[model samples]
Every structure is written in structure tokens, then in C-alpha cells.
Target: MNNQIKLSKEKREDMIALIKAYFLKERDEELGDLASGFFLDFITENLAADFYNQGVWDAYTYMNVKIEDLLEIQKY
Candidate 1:
């Protein structure tokens, strides 16, 4: 199973822009495309999996609740 998360080109650009803007706003450091791209890569490679796993867990919990509700309705 492929665990790699893939973003569309537009999404990638948007994220990069957001990263650049965030650093510029909060840190007062201007990040160029190369720097921001590297930062994005680092986040994507290292941190995204953790976030993705959390999302998967959240979805599982949500679906479980829905399934329980469905079962309850059937019991009525």
C-alpha cells in the first residue's frame, strides 16, 4: 500500500505560498520559493504522515459512531 500523500500542483503551490506568507508575517523572515519548497518538502515527508494517520483515526471513529447509530435505528 502506498502511504505517500500526493497533492495536486495547484494545492502544492497554494501551500508553498501559505508557508511563505506565514513566515513573513509571523517571523518577519522572507522565504523564497526554494526555501519554502524545502520547508514544504520537510513537512510533507516528516510530519504529514502523523497528521494523515490522525485524520484516518478520526474518520474511523466517526464511521464507528455512524455505524452504531445505524444499528440503534435498526433496533428501534
Candidate 2:
């Protein structure tokens, strides 16, 4: 599977902004636009898949519980 994920220009900028905010808030470090852009690129390239998989797993677990609840209601 191709591991490349593409983001729209607006979304890219938003992610960079978020990264900058994170650095400033958590690390007390000011991250420039260029550095934040590079950090976003690195995260998207390296970690997006794992993040996506985790989201899918979470959704699956939630749905299973909901389905079980429905089934139990139907048994009454």
C-alpha cells in the first residue's frame, strides 16, 4: 500500500499552526513557520498511518459495544 497521504493547502497550514501552538504551549519554545512545516511533514510521513489505524481501532471498538447494546435490547 502506498503510504503517502496528501493534505490540502489549507489543512497543511492549519497543521503547521497547530504544531507551532503545541511547541509554544508545552515546551515554551517558539517554532517558526518553516520549522513547524518541516515537523508537520515528518509527522504526516512517519506517524499518520499509526494514528489512522488507532482511530479505526477505536471506532471499531465503539461500534461493537453499540451493536451489543442493540442486540441486548432486542432480546427483551
Candidate 3:
């Protein structure tokens, strides 16, 4: 499929909640975009991969193919 499929309401909400959790955990705040002093790029990428592997959503898998390249390309 090519982005034609739609996720159910619960699945969509779950995705949003996951992103919210990541943002909150990374920023130590509920709104700010700043991530913890740690290597957030790594953390976020890994989180996305984990989500993809869980068989719930594929939003993150778009990055799965070039993950290694992305990791090498990112500065932080």
C-alpha cells in the first residue's frame, strides 16, 4: 500500500500519545521541543523503530530503510 490505508481512531490516538510521551520525556517538559542532553536523535530513531516493529503503525518505518544513513548524517 502507498499511504492509502487509514488507521482506526484508537490506533491514531495511540500514535499521537506515543509522540507526546517522547516529546515530554525528551524535553522534560510537556510542550517544549528540546530533548534531554543525551543523544536524542538516537533515542528517537530507536523509539520509532521499536514502534514499527511492534506491528501497530508504519509511520516510523518510512525512516527504517535509510535509518543507518540518517544516523550517520545527523549531528545530534
Candidate 4:
């Protein structure tokens, strides 16, 4: 599996801003734009796949439950 994740310019900026805000609020430290960008890139490359898989699993579970509920209602 490819380890690289691509984000559009707007999305990249948004992520960087979020990272900066997180550090500022949670760590009480200022994170520079370049540092935040690097951090975002590193996380996306290393952990995005796992996050994506978890999201897919969550969606599948939700859909399965909804389908079961629909099926039960259909029997009424």
C-alpha cells in the first residue's frame, strides 16, 4: 500500500492551521507554519492508512446496524 497521502492546497492549509491551533491550545506552544506542515505530512504518511481503515470499519458497522433495523421493521 502507498504510504503517501495527498491533500489539496486548501486542505493542506486547513490542516496546518488546525495543527498550529492544537499545539497552541493543548501544548501552550506556538507551532510554526513550516513545522505544522511537516508534522501534518509525517502523520498523513505514517498513520493515515490506519485512520482510513478505522473510518471504513466504523461506517460499515453503522450501515450494518441500520440495515438490521430496516430489516426488522420490514418484518412488521
- Highest TM-score, which number? 1
Poorly placed runs, candidate 2 (over 4 Å): none
lDDT of 1 by residue, 33-54 (tens): 9999999999988999999899
Task: Supply candidate 4's per-residue lDDT for 66.
Answer: 94
For candidate 4, write residues 1-76 as lDDT tens digits: 5657789999999999999999999999999999999999889988999999899999999999999888886643
What tens-digit string does per-residue lDDT give for candidate 2 at 1-76? 7879999999999999999999999999999999999999899889999999999999999999999888886644
TM-score of each: 0.89, 0.74, 0.34, 0.75
Candidate 3 TM-score versus the reference? 0.34
**By TM-score, is 3 or 4 better?**
4
Q: Show the colliding residue pairs in model 3.
A: none
**What is the lDDT of every predicted structure here?**
0.93, 0.93, 0.54, 0.92
In terms of lDDT, the poorest run of 10 residues in model 4 is 67-76
Of 2 and 4, the candidate ranking higher by TM-score: 4
Model 1 lDDT on a 0 to 1 scale: 0.93
Better of 3 and 4 by lDDT: 4
lDDT (10s digit) by residue, model 3, range 1-76: 3423345767655555666687778866563223232334444455655755566446456667579677888776
Q: 1 or 3, which is superior by lDDT?
A: 1
Best-to-worst TM-score order: 1, 4, 2, 3
Q: Return whichever of 1 and 2 wins on lDDT.
A: 2
